[model samples]
Target: MGLSGESQAAYHYTTTRCEWEFYIIVTHTSGPTGRRVLSDKHKERRVGDSREMVELITSNPSALGSLVTCDESWIYCYDPETKRQSSQWKQFDFPQTQKGQAEPELFKSGRWHLHQDNAPVHSSILVTNYLTEMGVKAVPHPPYSPDLVPCNFWLFLKLKENLRGSRFEDIEEMKEAVTRVLDIFTLEDYEGACKKWLECYNKCTEVGGSYCKGN
Candidate 1:
């Protein structure tokens, strides 16, 4: 979707947050009509580890064929209805390569691709080369396009708000709490969020502004 110049200031401000120091990845499945039907979320542990990322993708083939979207802290691959991992999941990285190897079948399935902003890790040579070799296409997202990613504008804020003023006994306990929250996210919630996302996108497009609200 395109925005008019009149809203450039708001749009630019929204996009700037896409470059924040940290963020998380979230995925949702969409129907043929472009409505989100499912969701699977993941927290990014670190950056610039192509090998680890390849493993993550291979392990979670159920997310394949979903519209994978993320903010600065997370990256997700997900599908709405399919519960089983794709048989082609094993081919994303080559098996014998030293750096990282993906299975050839994973790319051939044409089910997985990266939709990311131009963050340093997303644009790293290692990441790019590995994706290239794996034949996974990266979506051409404009710099600072937070409107294109739902997490920045909606979910993350809600998630943080839910965690506000809460204390955890330790990192492990915090992690468990976060996991429980994420696990309880029903498909209906994801679809509702996507509907809101489409509304925001339309509003931004109509006003020529970025779709993000300042934090």
Candidate 2:
């Protein structure tokens, strides 16, 4: 069947009909998770939430004054001055630490709201109860939606850029370096990040929540 779609398939498939078996396997078994794929329902939630955020900000420019975001990530660390210069990446995945449990004093002193994602840790009853007890609010984030998180679009980008190629002895030294970098950012920088958040929400709503990341 030279004229057939099956016959005209890629050479790899033609060689062994291997892709057909792969397709069957894929259909039968769940695939490994890597990148998140947003569903239509997620898009709906993102759009609605984004609109609310825009309106909230529009009605009150200071609405995001206490907003926070997910700022955790793997950072490469090394010290150029020592033999420990071999790259050692530190993975910060402590759910409790991320939810401010580690900084209970700060959260207790003042109300805090987080634009946190719907990860299992963030949504856990423990963290929720803690926030409620601390008089802090948790903004509802659409599932699988990171584009709306300001930290993703702004803070981390700038933070990593400033940290790139810089070396530090250990996690403590790296943490200090990160703090130093953050200290240099002016109020305008923070305001700009907030503005970018608003822009992202606007874009999300504009595109019916189907917008691309980093837009």
Candidate 3:
């Protein structure tokens, strides 16, 4: 879901051809020890490429604090290590929409910050002003680097796996299912996931993106 307009169109033409929708913001928390692992569902989608999966698992947040990440399709925050509160899930309709219009109180925590690649929506004046007014620090991230954010490769895979082998009767049902699955995460799980990133980072530094696995 994180693509520039041109790349997005190209991606659509080459990939499944599904039109990008709302923006999803996901945040994960780690345990006190900072050790976590991806859920069973996450592992399923990552069966083929351990290296890529590990890179996706690196963007682990601390248990005491929170992490914020988003894309054009959805905006959400979660503690990868802990069960998130129901109020944390937020769905945005469009980039032009007002900030905090859907759920003002969610951003009221004021303790959180956002790290996102500079996408058109993310860099938009309206979005920037809205995030500023909401007391969220939006930090710039490197482009074309999903490995920098563990969730892009790890948590997203888990989310997709959780939705597999099942049919959602409707969109509402799917949303409810997402909430239910997210509620079961714990800090320990997130730390396990973070280890994957460390493995990937070491591998890349040592062998230039060559294959490396943490046995």
- lDDT (0 to 1) per candidate: 0.42, 0.56, 0.42
lDDT of 3 by residue, 1-215 (tens): 33333212211000011111123332222212121354544333333343543343345444113434544232222222224423355442322212222333324556555656555666788888987787776543433445545555565656644444444444444455555554454566565655564564455445433323432
Best by TM-score: 2
Best of the two (2, 3) by lDDT: 2
| Regions more than 4 Å wrong, model 1 | 1-65, 74-109, 209-215
**What 10-residue stretch in candidate 2 is worst by lDDT?**
17-26
Residue 193, model 1: Cα distance from true site in angstroms: 1.9
Candidate 2, residues 1-215, lDDT tens digits: the string is 01233212211001011100000010111223233677888789989998888887788755776555553344456312223423555443322112111333334446445667776656788888987887676677787776776655666567666666666554455655565555565667767777887888899898887866555
For candidate 2, the TM-score is: 0.66
> Alpha carbon lDDT of residue 39, candidate 3?
51
RMSD of candidate 3 to the truth, in angstroms, is 15.3
Deviation in angstroms for 26 in model 1? 15
* Alpha-carbon shift of residue 123 in model 1 (angstroms): 1.7
